[model samples]
Target: MKKLVISIVLVNLLAACASQKPHETTAAPAAPVAAAATATAPATATVAAAKTAVDPLNDPTSILAGRSVYYPFDVAAVQDADKPLVQAHAEYLSKNAARNVRLEGNCDERGSNEYNLALGQRRADGVMKMLELGGAKAAQLDSVSYGEEKPKATGHEESSWSQNRRTDLNYAK
Candidate 1:
């Protein structure tokens, strides 16, 4: 009789377990580290998105987009209209210490090659000095004269001359 009763109890327990659904099994709670990471996922994504934004140098909307600073004929001075351009470049250079620039000075087709070369050198040097004074490091700036060899305009008129007398700011690769 005692053996029959034990067999009946074991059968009942087995039947109960077999009838339960698989999803009824209890699960351990999530880990603290995993919970924290899940909570902050959106904030982390936001920070990464902000960092991926474009740099001002490559941005089309920035004032630093202007590369050429035009000057009057035979003048080495930065014109009133172009001063802000130079200032913007200087600010950029100062903020980015690893960046370096080359100032290429050019002249119109009117002058002799020798005279044009010298004038171009003066123009490049003038811009270089201004950048240095505006907070750029001396080591970050270099000046070169292309003179009449690299004229922007080929005409003999004042319009072309005005376009050619300029300093081009080139960033190092």
Candidate 2:
């Protein structure tokens, strides 16, 4: 009878110890632990079930997925319409220090090569400034001008030109 009581006390102590210990990852709803079989085992299986976060950039519904900021003809400033897009990217970059982005500036086919290149640089730089102001580190950003070299649309119409004048936020792998 004494041996039976001691065994029960030992089992209660073991269960208490298991329940009180901290978990590195969140544990799921615990099952009724009927026996002492799992007392000494590491909880790797439970850790594997811990929830993981999906990156906002990869989530199509997030504003961070809107990578391109468009501009009017010969304009270098970011438009009011695209401010939210830039702000979201800026916030994401600020949070994820390991991530880096290249701001690629592109222009329409209406300007001289030198002029277009300079304008594109200004456009890229403008977005870079906004990102920095919004809390992203300068080290996580790079700006470059492609000028008219990388056109999103090849046609000479306003529709095509509108598509071409922009800066693209390209994330590094």
Candidate 3:
């Protein structure tokens, strides 16, 4: 277990170093001291976390980064899997009072234009309600139905349809 943990930590440190741009440096490498290194690890981790929290919406690893909530075929309600995403956005929005979002509801091509529009509205409204309940204020949210007009996927299959049946969280600039 210790070897496995050490190997994972080594891989992560190497990856972090590799991701940085090259820079001129004359400083000597810090000496390896396991106890001292472990003691400072939490401080480094806290700083990294604080940096990400500054703008979690743009952080791909953050739960708030998920901008769309998908539903099963013809379903207007948010699935259990999407609840966490919605809650994350709600918390983020609540904390950042100035940030506003639009709930764009969409649907697959199987339904008539009117039916799709209505369904899309239902989907968007459902997400809006959940966001409000989770902590976001109603004033920060606007609901709109794009119906089948815009699609994340263009193929005519379950893969595409699944993508279309979603409510997108569009943040205002």
Candidate 4:
């Protein structure tokens, strides 16, 4: 009976040992540290998408070099100095009449829409006159008035208002 009982106890112990996990002799081969590095690396396609999303106008040099020119409205009263800028634009247009150019006149938000529209038209006419003087044919240039409908800056402050009150020359191919 003692031998049977000992055998039964030994069998139970063996079964328990079999169910439990065995102790590892060596540490898991330093789980490839490079896996963590590769996981954190930015995807190539995502990086390309991010690059493509950047605005071209964010660069001041690009804005300045572009064919579009901005003219101050009220404060910088139309003066003799502005003639040269207009002339340069006219020359550019003469050289490229096959391409159409739009002169958008804008005004500050100080006046009613009607008044602003008239003022914007006058501003555009002023630019047109100069362009004509500079040799841009009437057929090549088109003028439109945004009035105060579209503003370069949204704030009510004078600085923003000043920026909003301007003419923009946009060239289209």
Q: Whole-model Cα lDDT per candidate?
A: 0.75, 0.75, 0.76, 0.58
* Candidate 1 lDDT tens digits, 15-115: 55334312121111113224433554678876466436855567554557678777666888887666766877887799778989999999988779889
Q: In candidate 2, how many Å is residue 68 off?
A: 0.2
Candidate 4, residues 1-173, lDDT tens digits: the string is: 97787568656654553343121101121132233225436676664564367422222222212332333444323444344445556755665567556778888787798888887777777787777777788988888989889988897645566566677777664
Tell me the spans in candidate 2 whose CA falls farther than 4 Å from its real position.
1-53
* Full-model lDDT, candidate 3: 0.76
> Between which residue pairs do clashes occur in model 3?
none
Per-residue C-alpha lDDT of model 3 across residues 84-117, encoded as one tens digit per residue: 6787788778877999999999998988988999
Candidate 2 lDDT over residue span 63-113, tens digit each: 665788878779999876677678778877887899999999999998898
Cα error, candidate 4, residue 162 (Å)? 0.9
TM-score of model number 4? 0.56
List where candidate 1 sits over 4 angstroms from the true fold: 1-52
Residue-pair clashes per candidate, as listed? 0, 0, 0, 0
**By TM-score, how accurate is candidate 3?**
0.70
